[model samples]
Structure formats: structure tokens, C-alpha cells
Target chain A: MSLKMRLGLVFSGALFLVAVAAWIYQLKEGLILTNMQNSYSWGLYISGLAFFVGNAAGGLVLTSSIYLFGVKKLKPLAKLGALTAFANVTAAMLIVLPDIGKPIRLYNMLLHPNWMSPLVWDVIVLNLYAAAAAIYLYILMLPELTGRLGWLAIRVDDPHAFSERWAKRIAPVALLFAIGIHVVTAWIFSTQGARDWWFSPVMAPDFVSVAIAVGTTVVLLAAALAYGTGEKYQEAYRALGLIIFMATCVHLFLMANDLVIHSWYGNAETHRIMDIAWGDFGPAHLFEVAAPLLGAWLLMRPQILGSLPRLLASSALLIAGVFVHRFLIMPAAYNNIPMTMTPFGLPESHWSLPIASGRFLPGMGTFLDQYAYFPSLVEVAILIGIMAYAVFLVLLAIARLPILARENQ
Target chain B: MKMGMVIDLEKCIGCRSCMVACKQHNAQPPQTWWNRVFTPGSHRHLTPPALGVEFFLPVHCQHCENAPCEKVCPVGATYHAEDGAVLIDYERCIGCRYCMSACPYGVRQFNWEDPEKAHARSEYQEKYHYGYPEDHRHEGRLVYSPLRPKGIVEKCTFCAQYRDKGELPACVRGCPGKARFVGDLDDPDSDVSRLIKSRNAFTLLPEKGTKPTVFYLPPKAKEV
Candidate 1:
């Protein structure tokens, strides 16, 4: 047992414990566990699900490398990307479970679905994407699985012939499945209709670009952690860092174009939300504009923040920024039921519906307000559990399989 | 047996009586309702006293001849029956909320939790579909009718459950102004059928061609 592996196990185990405890408490309490209600039908859980699903685009990003760009040197990380996509998607599904009124009956969506609803389309597309991504990941893993099993025998001078032959056949076919997952997921968000921001013509490219940015961030962070255990995976880390930089550039370009159009022709309702980019949500504003700018800035001088700790901090910033982008983008396109007045010109009544009805004020106790959806302690715990669960699985696979064997080296 | 509706827009005061009546009769929770009043295209920017609100469309499911909700339901939970009334089999509903999202008019409502929270005991017992089966009327909780469950999709059934029992729909019966007309669209002499024939009527989003059976009277000019 390597020291790096031992430490990974401990950290993951602690997170897993906290997450399980929180999730159990929430399950017992229903959706009241989160700061959610009828008006805000979707809040933290849905947003988190969207981001996690977006992260599955990492496999598509990797396919672009070995298949599109012909970067054969980056081949080893392809499976890592697939693993990350699968883990994130699985985690996303778990988050959705407790978010609904009755998690068990989520399938009734298929039974009673209105064909026109974009929310229904999201479910269909997400399920298809998940299936495709899983198949893609498994196809890539087949050879590796066979290789590890053979190694277990080879070290003792015994080997199986059929497993090696089967492994050789499946590798090429997995590539197609990889591209399908991200493209389909992109279509789900982009094609929702007239959501100006999400329904933009540049959605497909934007989806791929952001996924690559987040995906590489995940890989780079993984490699950085590997370094503390003296695994010396700096070359791999740098390779992922470069991908992150390029993807960040592509993502920023799409955002710039989208923002320009919005600035020019955005409706009154849209301007109210987009103003947050420059308004009092300073940390969020900084995360969206400045953090990425600083990320791009750091790339120019990698020696400054390229070390393990700083790299982690920057990766955290990138994650936070992308998340904020999802938060704003999802709620950004909503239509607020405007306040009405009496015929006599007096204010008639305040309105209540799903989107804008929540009463929120900005302060330390902001979470109690209607619009203030700070993930409850249970929500945070569940999220932490999911992250830890993914990490635990990855570490266990590495420990058990010959994932980073000297044969590859 | 194609039962349907024709609403006289001129008489619709937007008092929301029909909506309130639907909620009360159906015993729907305060927030969950099958019918809604949308006053779209407010002529707020129009010159004063020029019919400031363009129209009030009291909308529910059209019980379309070519229903989009029926086609998209993966489990075959919602379907157009032999009588042409769209029906939902609640026993299989997963409540994915697809129908609610898909209906352009947004008529579908989720039973987000148990229906009891929204229904008083007397109301839930009296008005719930299937009426707690033949034997379970006194039980504290009734297994939801085959037409509704926590996870399954639900929408306006044209009050098919009541129509089957020779009762006027809760909404249609409870309407105070008699502004709403419901009858067999197949029978030319049915009051709603006659109403549609005399009025310049249209369904919302007719361009989508769902061919909704419900019709609305285009308000005609009246002497001041």
C-alpha cells in the first residue's frame, strides 16, 4: 500500500462518512432538508445536476485529443476522462434522487410526460447520455480490465489468450460512443427554445469548451494530489493544464460573444439578471470574470501558481466560476410575473409563482429568505459525500487494478 | 361522445370564479390547479380605456384530437380513449413532470407530495377520483386513484371521471356566471357544439395543430 494511496483512502473515507450521515437525515425529512419550496421548484439540486452532467463532457474532450487532434501522447488520460465523466454523472443522479417529492416515482416522468416540456426532454437526453457514456467508458475499460487480469497471472507466468484478443477488438468502437454523450447532452440544454442564453446558436461549441475546461481541471487536480505521494506525475499534470488553458480560452470566447449579443439586444427582464455580473454579487462577479481572467493570467506565468497547493486553489476557483455560470444561466432566462396595479392606479397585489416569488435579502442569515437557497447542512453533506464517493471509487480502482503500472511507464 | 367546452370570452370577467371553483370542487391544493386565467398581451402601453387588457384566456387541457401529451408519454399512461376523451392511468404515472413542462399553456400540475396536505379530509374523501375504492372510504389515507399518484403525470381530464358518472365537471357546475359551456362536441345540438358553431372560436396555440376540442368566443363589440 503506497503512502499516497493510504492518504487518499483516509481523506475519501472521512468525506464519505459525513456525506452519508447528512443524506440519511435529509431522506427522512423530505425536500424540506434543502431551502426549497413550491415556487423555486428547482434550486441547488437541479443546478448541481446540470453541472455534474456537463462535467461528463470530459470524455468528449479527451476524444478530441487522441482522435481529432491526433495527440497520441495523451492517450493514457482518455480512460481517466471517461472515469471522471461516469463518476460525475452517477453523482448527479444521486443528487436528483432526494430533490424530488418522491424519488421512487421519478420514472412516472416517462408515463405522464408532456412531449413539449423541455424539462422532460432534459430527462430523456440525460438518460440517453448516461447510457452512451457508460458504454463508452466500459468499452475503453475492457482492454484495461483484461490487461490487469492477465497481469495477475503473468507475474506468476500464467496467462489467458481469449481475453487479450477480445480487448484488442473493442478499443476502436468505444470512440464513437464517447462523442455521442457530450453532443447529445449539449443539445438538451441548447435546444430548450428561446432561453436566449441557453438556446444560443453557439451552444454545442460552448458545451464542449466548458466541459473540456472543467474536465482538465479535474484531471490536473488529480495529478497534483498524486504528486504529494511522490508519484511524480508532473508531465501529466502539465499536459492537462495546457488543455485546461485552451478550453478556458474557447469557453471565454463563447461567453464573450453571448454577452455581447445580450448587451445589445437583451430584454428588460434579462438585463435585470445580467446586471449581477457588474452588481453587488461581487464574489460571483469576480468568479465569472476575474477568476477566469486570473486563471488565464496564471497560465502565462505557470511557475507562480502551478505548484500543487496553488494549482488546487486555482482549480477550486475555476470550479466555483463555472458553477456560478450555471447558477446564473439557469435562472437567468426566467420570466418574472410582473406586479399588477388596480384600475385606480394603486398597487394591486404582489404575485407568487415558481421563479421570482421567493423573498430573499442579502445578509448573513440570507439562507432563511425565500430566494436565498444556500444548500442546507444536509445538502452540503450529501454533496461532499458524492465527491468523496467518486474519489474513493477512483482510488480503489487504482489500488486494485494495474491502472498506473510500470508496464505503461 | 367527444365531450368538450366553449368559453365565452366576453362574459369572462377574469374574476377567476372558474379557477376557484375548479380548485374547490376538485379539492386541489391551494397551489395545484388544473385551470388558470392568463391575461396576456396587457394593453398597458395602449391608449387609456382601450380595453387595457387584450383578453383573458381561461385555459385547461384542450382534450386535443391529436394530443401531444398522449403521444409523448413513454409508459402509455396518458391516451385518447375510444370516446376521444384523453385519459390518464395514474397507477403507472412516474411524475417526471414532462406533461406539465410540455403543455404550452402549462395546465398540468404535479402532486408534488401526497394529495392529503392540500385536501381537507371531507373534500379528499368526497372528490378524490374513485372515492377511496369500494371498501376504504374511512381509511385515513386512500391509495391515490388510478389517474393520480405522487410521481405520475396528471392534467385536466375534461373531468372525465365525473362525466362518466353523469355529473357536470366540478369546474363547469361550479362556474357562477354560466360563462363556460360544456357538452358533447359530437352532438351538433349540444349547447357547446351550438356555441362553437355560432361564435368565431379559436383554441390557444392552434398553430401547433394539437386540434384542441375546447373553443373560445372572440369577444364582439357591445353598445356602451
Candidate 2:
């Protein structure tokens, strides 16, 4: 293994252990360890779920599209893309274990599943996405694996031809599942009319766009770093960059379209809610917009695309940007109850719900009109652990498997 | 029977008796209120809004006929009881808090920690673990317990335990001003129905279209 990969594994392994410890402590103490109260019930953990799901969806979708469309340029990176997707979807599922109040009682979600809840659909899609990505990845690696472990294999005259044929059939299924996973995730928020921000038609399609942008970013970054960004892979890099940029622009347009309507609603309650994203949360929202655009711009620049370090940084920025977008989903939705919408003639000051903050603050007031949530130290620790583990897995897979041998050195 | 509540905003003195009584009988944990009295548009509970008159708007589970909480609970933990009340089965809940988010009224509260830890803070509570000291089950669902299990959702069951015994809810009985009433909302001749009809009754956030069973009589230039 490379020094960077070894260092990453060690670092992530250490953090993942710490995350396990923190999660155990959290389970022992119940959700009291979390900053989430009844007021802001869903927090950083849910954001992580959304962000990682988008990453997972984006990766596999890119891989499958290569087969479906027969995009020769992206063919080489298909294995790595599938690997990334498999790892992320797994991480996405694991992270949700900590977010729930009774992690042990998760079986209840399966045994007594309510078909009406979008969350149940999310549970199914996420699991299905993980399983399919794994199978899809094995197919991508079949030729290489058969060569290395010849004794165990039924020899195909052309292993490459056989695997490619299988990959073609799985491509459409994987692509549709990727889209399904994202739509289900978005519906987990959107189906509920209680949250004004989430109850929109655009959330699902917008999530798909975001998945495409961030997913391709991961593939681009991984391909550039793993195989080395050389003249041989120039066309692939260009195509991937265009995909990321176009998808990101589409995401931004939809977001802006939603924001414009909110701005024009011409009501005090809406203006106040809009002020949350436009005012107090402006810096975070600003970063959400600027990072992806800058990163996409860097990749689009052919000179910067060749610079491996620049490619890595752009990918990091784009990933960070979408993560922020996932997080921004909660604030406007959770910070205020939509019930505060006053009658047509009532004055503008229909206040935010004064909700009980579950944990005792010693001397501080327990009730808040509008609570600003920051993840507790334990929550942050667990989040870091999950992300690091996903990174470690992706790196380990690429290095260990002879998977990328067909591509450039 | 479509059981529901009708609270007259004018008659409530902001005494918090109903809030206190509900807490006592229902055994809510620290900082968890199934029934909360608020002065609407005020920064603090019971504080007057810009309207200058300090009237109370006590809120709880509306027990909507088209309940969002019931629909959103992934485990079918939250359900509409036979009496038209939205209820949670503590044993069945996965504590996902989806129902908490789905409720527009914001009445749902999760057990952040053990109920005993909540009781430890107050000397009075430490000595006396109040509420009806029994597990009340309806049709095999553990709807009410003296202390709910940690890591699950709980909310107003409209005093299901007391109602089963043919008694008024703790909140309704404890209202010193007699401002609260409960009856079969489905029955046209019921007291709650007549009160709702006569008093310009409204449910909170009618625009939400949850079709709340609980009604509120908006104060119409009345001095209590």
C-alpha cells in the first residue's frame, strides 16, 4: 500500500474506534448526549445520511451510465466508481444507527414497517442500493479477480467480454435504483406537510442532480489520484468535469427557483423563514453555493484538471459544498413549526414555537422560541469517524484489488 | 366515539393548572410537556404578545383525523386509537422521531434519558413518582405507563388511562376556571360540540388540513 493509503487507514481506523466508543456512550446515556431536542429533532446525523446517500447515488449512477451509454472514456473508472458507491451507502446506513433514540430497536422499522412513511421507502432503497452496488462492483472486477484466483474460477474464454455483458444488463437497474434511492431520501423530508421548507415537489429531482454532481466529483478525484491524471485519461477527465458542472448548475437553478418563490410569497411568516436562510444562516448558505461552483470551474479548466493536487482540492471543496447543502436542509425546516402561519389578517408577528429543549442547561432557560443547533462534541466525533471510515474503505479497495490495472499507471 | 377537547381561550387565567395537572397525572419527564400553555406571539410562556392582552393558548396533541404523525411513523408505532385520538405504542416505537417532526402542533416529546434521572432533579418528584401508577394498555398496545421507556416517543394520549376508567382527563378536571370540556366530538348533541358551535370554535392551523379533533374557542372581546 502507498504511504498515503497506509496513513489514511491508520487515521480512520483510530477515529472509527473512537466513534464506536462515543456511540456506545451515547446509547448508554440515551439521546441526551445529542444536542437535538424536541425542537430541532433531526440534526447533523440526518444531514450526514443525506450527504453520504447523495455521494453513494452519484458514484454508482456515473458507473452505470458508462455502460448504458457506452461512454468509452469513463469505462476505465467504472470499477472505482462502483466501489465508492458501495462504501458510501454502507456508511450512510451505519450513521443512521446513532441518530435514532433506540438504535437497538431498529428492527421495529422492518417488522412493523408502515408503508405510508417515506422513511420505510428510504430504508428499502438504501439497503437495495448497497446490495446492488456490491454485485455491480464484483461484475466490474470479475475479469481481474478471475485471473488472480484462477483455481476457483470457471474459466470463460474471454472474462472481460463476459463481465462487460453482465455489466450492461445491470446498468439500467443500478441507474434506476440510484435515482430511486435519492428520490426516497428526498421524500423522507418532502412528504410531510409540517415542514414548510421540505414540502416541495423539487426536493427529489434536486437531490438527484446533487447526487450526480458530487458522485462524479468522487469518481473524478479518485481516478485522477489513483491512476495519475495523464494525457491518456484526458478525455475522461474532461467528460467527468462537464457532468459535474452541468449537474451542479442544474442544482443551483432549482434551489434559486425555490428561494425566489419563497421571497415573493409576500407574507410576514415566509419573510421571517426566508430571513433564516437569507440572514442568520447566510455564511453557511453562501459556502454551499460558492464551493461547488468554484470546484466545478477548476475541473472545467483543462490546465488545473491535469494538476493532481488541484483536482483533489477541487473535489474536497465540492464534497464540502454538497455536505453543507444537506445540512442546510434542516435549519429552515426544523427551526420553526409551519403551524405558526397566522390567519390572513393577523399581524406579522406569529412567533416561532417556544419549544422545550430536552436536556437541562443548569441555569439556562429550557424553552426556546428559535433554537440554533450545533452538533454536540460526541455527535461531531461520530460524524468524523463515519466520514473517515468511508474514505479509508474507498482507498483500501482501490489499492488492494488489481481492479484498476486495466487503466493507466 | 370521536373524543376531543374544547378549551375556551377567554376563561383560561394562564394559571398553568391544566399544564401542571396533565404533567402530574401523565408522568411527563423533565422539560417534556404533553400539554403546554403559551401566550401566542410572546417570547416566553404566558408572556403577553404585542396585542397587550395576556390571553393563553394552551396547546397539545390535536389528535387530527388526518393525522400526519400517524402517517409518518415508520414503524406504525403511532396510530389513531378507536376513540379518535392519535396515540403512540411505546413498545412498538423505534424512536426515529419522524412522528415528532410530522406533528404540526409540536406536542410530541422523546425520552432523552431515563425517566428516573428526570425525577432526580426535583425533591418533590423524587419522593413521589406521580401519575396513575399503572401500565394502561388498549387492545394490546401499551399506550400509557407511569414512566415511559427511554429512547421512544410519547405524547398526549388525551388521558387515555383516565378516560378508560370513565373519568375526565386530568387537564379538563384540573382546570380551576372550568374552561376545559371533553366529549364525543362526533356527536352533534355533545357538550363539546355545542360549546364549539356556540363559541366560534377553531382549531390551531386549520390551513394545515390535519382536521384536528381538539377545538379552541377564540376570545371574542371578553373579560375573564
Candidate 3:
């Protein structure tokens, strides 16, 4: 293995170990270790899940589009995008495992699933997408898989013909599943009538638009990183950068529309959530807007978009911006505590006790008090570990899988 | 028949007897309460208010007819029971806490730690007692246990155990002020139904459209 690969494995392994330790501790103690309170139930983990799921969309769209549209120039990059999609969707699904309060009882989701719940729909769609992505990746790699392995050589007479025919047939289905995964996830939040921020009509479309932007950017960055600034890969880099720029523009437009509509005639709850976003969490909002704008500007310059290093940096910024956007969306709405009757007096005589020290304790008077949530140390560690694991999975695939096709083909 | 409660905000002294009774009956973990009493006017706890709204408002699971929490539960862990009360099936819960987020009233609480450990360290340990023992079956059905295991969502069950025995909810029976009335909301002659008709009762967050069964009678000026 290369030194870079060796170092990456070691780093990711260490992170995975730490994550495991944190999860074990959480399992022993329960979710009390996290900063999530009754007011803000879903926190960093759900946001991470949403972000990663969006990241998976780029690969699916790119690879499926390549097949369906017969984009000859982008044909060589199809496997890379498909593999990235497969890895990311798997990572997205895995990250939520630790966030579940009863990880062991997760099977109940399938066994006694409530069709009315958007989460159940999300689970089904996500799993179907993952399966489709995997099959798509495997079908794309059938030639290598069938030829290299002796046992597999007997199963297929012409691997190339088999892969070509199968790939053509599966592209449309994969595309549909990819779009469905993101829509279902967006619906999970939007369906909640109580959450004014999430109940917007623009949620699903915005989710798809942003997902395409981030996903394509990730693929572009990965391609640039692996293949370097060679003349052969320049066309792919420029094409992806153009796609990212357009998608980011759409995402920004939708964001503006949502903000305007929300502020124009929304309820008091909506105004309160918007206030929190623009006030206390202003930096995150600004970063979400500014980073993509910067990336779009860079993409307008042909020279910068064509160059590998510049394209990689621009893509990185866009991806980070979308992530911040996802992070901001998840918790901002929950900060508006629901209407409750204020206590006649403090619940306890003393406020010095550790339990009573919470900022929005029960008897703190008003039900509409500002609620704050920041992921605790253990949550941060687990998040870091999940990211590292995704990196490790990508590295593992690149090293073992026939992801990079021969240039002549 | 739909079971529900009618709380007289006029008579509530904010003593939190309902909260204490719930804790004592359910033996919930530290930092978790199925019921809570809130003072309305000020943001700071115990601050004397100029608004003259001195009455305390005790809030718990409203047991809504159109429950948001029930609709959002992925595993059907939370469901509307036969008597219109929302209950959690602990064994089926995946602990995603979607219900907690969906609940506009924020009545649900997740067991962040083991109940045994929380009970041991709790200041109210002396008052804690299990309403039903673990693995103790009653009449061929597993008795509802007050102690919840770690990592599951829990909330008030409307005292289903007491309801099954034809007794009132612990909170209603324990109220020093005798301010709470529980009965069949569908029954015309029931106290809750009669109070809702005669007293100009109001439900919390009517805009949410949860259709909460709990009704509140506005406090009189003299009471404040």
C-alpha cells in the first residue's frame, strides 16, 4: 500500500476505535451523554444523516445521467461516481445506528413499521437506493469481477457484453431510487406540522437541488484528488464544476424563496425560528450562503474551474457550505420551545442543584423561553469517527475495487 | 368511550402535588417528569408577576384525539389506546425520539440513563416506589411497570393501570386542591364533559389541531 493510504487507514482506524468506545459508553449509560434535551430532541446525528444522504445524491445523478443520456465524454467517470454513491449511502445509513436510543430494537422499524410515518418511508427508500446503487456499481464492474477471479470466470462467457446490457437496463431505476431517497428524507421533517421551519412546501425540491450540488462537488473533488490535474481529466472536472455551479444557484434561489415567504406572513413560531437563525446562529447561516456564492464565482472562471487544485478547493467550499446549511436547518426550528403553561413558581426551592441548573428548566416561567442545544464531547467524537469511517470506506474501495477504468476503454 | 381530564386553573395553587404524585406513582428517572406545573407570567422561576396570573398551570400528556406524536412514530411504538389515551409500547420503541420532536406540548421524555442509577442518586429516592414490579403478571396480563428501562421514550399513560382497576389517576386522587376531574369525555353526565360544557374550558395550542382531551377552566381574578 502507498504511504498516504497507510496513514489514512491508521487515522481512520483510531477514529473508529474511539467512536466504538464512545458508543459503548452511551450504550451503558444511555443518551444522557448527549446535549439533546426534551426541547431539542434530534440534534447533530440527524443533521449528519441528512448531510450524508444528500452527498450520496451527486454520484447517483451523475452515473445514471451518464448512462441514460449516453454522455460519451463522461462515460469513463461513471464507475467512480457510482462507487462514491454506494459508499456514501451506506455511510449515511450506518451513522444513524448509534443515534437510535434502542439500536437493538431497530428491527421493529421493519417488523411493525407504521406506513403513516415519513421515517418508515425514508427507511424503505434509503434501503432500496442503497441496494440499487450497489447493484449498479457491481454491474458496472462485472467485466473485471468476472474475468479476474477464476471461480467467477466460469459463470459468465462474455463479461463485457453482460455488463453493458445490464447497465443500460438499470440506469433509469437507479435514477428514480436516487431521487426517491432524498424526497423521502425531506418529507420526514416537512410532514411534522408542529415544526414550522420544516413544514414548508419547498423542502423536498430544496433538498434535491442542494443534494445534487454537494454530491457533484464531492465527486469532482474526489476525481481531481485521485487523477490529478492531467489533460485527460480536465473535461470531466470542468463539466462537474459547471453542474455544481448551476445546482448551487438553484439551491440559493430556493433558500431565498423559503426565507422570504417565511418572513413575509408566517406565524409567530416561524418568525421566532427565523430570528434565532439570523440572530444567535447568524454565522452558520452566513457561511451557508457565502461559501456557495464564493464557489459559484470561482466556477465562472474557466481557468480556475479547469485546474484540478482550484476546482478541488471550490468543490470543498460548496460541500462544506451545504453541510453547514443542513446543520443549521435541523436544530434552528427546535430552539422555539412550544407553548406551555408557565409554572406558578419554581419547581424546587433551590436552583443550585445540578439537575435544576439547566437553562430552560421546567419552572423557569414562560413556555416560549429560548432553548439552546450543542452536541456534547461524546457526540462530537462519534461524529468525527463516522466521517473518518466514510473516508476509510472510500479509500478501501479505491484500493481494492476496479473503480478506475483503463484509459483506452 | 374517550377518557380525559378537566383541570380547574382557578383552583390550582401551583403546589405541584400532581407532579409529585406522578413521580411517586411512576417512579420515573431523575430529570424526567410525566407531569409539570408552570407559572405563566414571568420568564424567571418564582418571580412575582404584575400580570395578576398567579395560578400555576400543570401540564402533562393531553392524550390528543388527533395526536402528532402517534402519527410520526416510525415503529408504531407510540399509539392511541382503545380509551383514547396515547401509550408507548416500550418493547417496540427504537428510541429515535421522533415523537418527542413531534409533540407540540413536549410531554414525552427519553430515558437518558438507567432508571436504577437515576433513582439511586435522586433526592426524591425516599419517596420513589415501584407501582408495579418487573415480571409481575396480573390476571394473565403483564402488569404495567412504573420503572422504565434505559434508552426508551416514556410519558404519562393516563394512569391506565388505575383506569383498568376502576380507580382515578394518581394525580387526580392526590390533588390537595381537588382541582382535577377525570372522566369519560364522551359521556354527557361525566364531570369532565359537564365542566367542558358549562365552564368555557379551553385546550392548549388549539392551532396545532391536536384536539387535546385535557380542558382548562380560566382562573378568576380573585384567585390570582
lDDT score of residue A176 within candidate 1: 47
- Candidate 3: tens digits of C-alpha lDDT, residues A262-307: 8888665556777887877888899999998798668656788667
Stretches of model 2 off by over 4 angstroms after superposition: A147-158, A341-348, A407-409, B44-47, B50-52, B121-127
Better of 2 and 3 by DockQ: 2
Clashes of each: 16, 0, 6
Candidates' C-alpha lDDT: 0.58, 0.83, 0.77
Better structure of 1 and 3 per DockQ: 3
Report how closely model 1 matches the true complex, as a DockQ value: 0.15
Residue B152, candidate 3: C-alpha displacement in angstroms: 0.5
Q: Which stretches of candidate 3 lie above 4 Å from their native place?
A: A150-154, A340-369, B44-48, B120-144
How far does residue A195 in candidate 3 sit from its true spot (Å)? 1.3
Q: What is the TM-score of chain A in candidate 2?
A: 0.95
